[model samples]
Target chain A: DVKVTQSSRYLVKRTGEKVFLECVQDMDHENMFWYRQDPGLGLRLIYFSYDVKMKEKGDIPEGYSVSREKKERFSLILESASTNQTSMYLCASSFEGYEQYFGPGTRLTVT
Target chain B: QQPVQSPQAVILREGEDAVINCSSSKALYSVHWYRQKHGEAPIFLMILLKGGEQKGHDKISASFNEKKQQSSLYLTASQLSYSGTYFCGTGVMEYGNKLVFGAGTILRVKS
Candidate 1:
């Protein structure tokens, strides 16, 4: 079975703080993605990486950046956290053109 | 663009059936379905790649209409364990491996 793990299950940060969410996948998938889930908004993509050092912006990439320095790990970075950035962050990895496997998710709270 | 889901929520008895629909304005290369229980990561349910193709496991099935850029998930003889939020993720050729997910349809099952 494929497994995706996130660095944190829940996190709290003050406004103007920097936050990082990490994800690792054991399946050696080529594509990794970051998404934020909010009520009535579903899962909106933040960023995605197809290969090491290759990144692409999804529909809602503002205030967020991603890093894919290695094939197994992907990280999402919030340069400066804000209250509006609080959300459930999900990381997913998949083979090109295949179903994505998601991590357990990190619920981030910004105060 | 994000896919639109119908019947934002639904309630069903143990033996009843329900259908959740997802529609997209753009052409779709594939349609993926996932079910996420409360406080858990979304789990991949099924993926429909061919136009007009129907696929399922157990009593849950899905159909993709490529021409109409839409897909529908069917749950028959639902069980308590089937209660969750159902999300449809649509993949477009132009979007590469990224999927645009719908807002989600919440399902509640009563014994």
Candidate 2:
């Protein structure tokens, strides 16, 4: 079965701290994405990478950066975490225009 | 712009049926549906391509109207395990591989 895995199931950090969230997929998908979900806001795309070293900004990309150095791993980075950035972060991977397989998600809290 | 979803929340009793709708302002290349249980990642339920087709998995089915740029998910004879937040993600040519999501519809099932 295809699997997407996140580095942490939960995380807590201080405001202004730099944070990194890692995602790895065993499916070797060409497209990977990072999304932040909040109550009532649903899932908002932060960034997506189409290939190794190729990245695209989504609707809500501010304060966030992503890296896809390898085919199986994608990384989301918070330059300076803030309280408002606290939410559940989800990582997904898919082939081109197909359905996505998602990680279990990381619940992040910035206090 | 993000696609819009209707009926932000709904409740269903066992064996009841429910429909959730997602509409996009821009023309769509495809629509992806997912179900995210509380505190978990969104799981891929189905994908509707641009051919104006309908598909089903288990007791759930969905229709996509390419002309209307809309998709509706139908849940039949709902089960307790069906309780979760349903999200419809829209993929547009302008956005490339980025799948923009709706605000999501929350569904609760009771006995």
lDDT of each: 0.94, 0.91
Clashes of each: 0, 0
User: DockQ (Cα-based) per candidate?
Assistant: 0.90, 0.87
Interface RMSD of each: 0.5, 0.8
Correct interface contacts retained, every candidate: 0.85, 0.90
Q: For candidate 2, write residues B2-54 as lDDT tens digits.
A: 88998899999999999999998999998999999987778889888887554
Off by over 4 Å in 2: B53-56
Clashing pairs in 2: none
Cα lDDT tens digits for candidate 2, A35-81: 99888888898999999999999879999999889999999999999
- TM-scores, all candidates, are 0.97, 0.96
Query: What C-alpha root-mean-square deviation, in Å, does candidate 2 show against the real structure?
Result: 1.3
Residue A48 in candidate 2, Cα distance off native in Å: 0.4
TM-score, model 2 to reference: 0.96
